[model samples]
Target: MRLLPWTGAGGKPCYLSTDDPHSPLSRLADDIEALHLADAAGVLEGARAVLDDPGAGEHAVRFALARAVESLGDTLRVAVSRGECA
Candidate 1:
């Protein structure tokens, strides 16, 4: 059982049961995980910029925080899916 990067309906975690790593669904999951990781990298950079700005407003900080939290979740999921985390 492999945990997919995205959730199912009602925010439940989705899993993939397959032996073929190159299967269509497996490939799709791999592609989506890659996208999530890439997006997380960009989000981390933006969040750092926002935090480093002394003049950044509350709204800007909050928005950056929200995006950072979301990206963190995605990145964690990817890690778990790849067996990088225990």
Candidate 2:
């Protein structure tokens, strides 16, 4: 079973039960994971800065938070997928 990079509509973890690691979905997940990791540092810093500022606008905070949550979900999916292989 492989964990997909996106959650279901009900906020549940979605898993792909398959033996092929080279499937299209798996490759897409890998790409998404790579992109997230590459931008992690910048996103973390931006979010931290926005959160630390007392006068930051709600829009800025919300955007940062949304990105953080999405990135976390993607990272978790990748980890779960790798663990299944292990």
Candidate 3:
């Protein structure tokens, strides 16, 4: 069973049960995962910039933090789906 990157209704984890990793759904999941990782990289950079800026306001920091948290969740989900977690 391969855990998909996206959740189902009610925020439940979705899984793919297939021997063919190249199947349509599997490919879609792979693509989405790649996107999530790419977005995470950008979010990390932006968050760092916000944190390093002394002139940044609370709103700016909070926004960056929210995005970072969201990206972190996505990245963690991808890791778990890929069996990278211990």
Candidate 4:
């Protein structure tokens, strides 16, 4: 999965690309809301772990991707909570 975030320095919040962004969770945003939430959570958790742990052993590039994914999830949650997911 490839995630691009808007926040903090540079154009990305966290930098990591996934081999697959079409997970069941991502499908929620398109075909199912519930699945989207679950997938989004997965992305966020991955990002949060990297953010909280600098030496998490994740390569710099991968770490950045995780951060970006986390930020993207946060953005999505905000939008959903605001009833903008219609």
Number of the top candidate by lDDT?
A: 3
Local accuracy of candidate 2 as per-residue lDDT tens digits, 1-86: 66777778898877878778798987887787787676676788899999999999989999999988877666666667678433
lDDT of prediction 4 = 0.54
Task: State the local distance difference test value for candidate 2.
Answer: 0.78
The clash count for each model shown is: 0, 0, 0, 12
Best first by lDDT, ranked: 3, 1, 2, 4
What RMSD does each model have against the real structure?
0.8, 3.6, 0.7, 11.7
In model 4, which regions exceed 4 Å deviation? 1-31, 57-86
Model 2 RMSD in angstroms: 3.6
Error of 1 at 24 (Å): 0.8
Candidate 4 clashes: the total is 12
Residue 81 in candidate 1 has what lDDT? 88
Candidate lDDT scores, in order, read 0.94, 0.78, 0.96, 0.54
Candidate ranking (TM-score, best to worst): 3, 1, 2, 4
Give the least accurate 10-residue stretch of model 3, judged by summed lDDT: 77-86
Task: Provide the TM-score for each candidate, comma-separated.
Answer: 0.95, 0.60, 0.97, 0.35
Model 1 lDDT per residue over 19-53, tens place: 99999999999999999999998999999999999
* Cα lDDT of model 3 by residue, 2-86, tens digit: 9999999999999999999999999999999999999999999999999999999999999999999999999999999988983
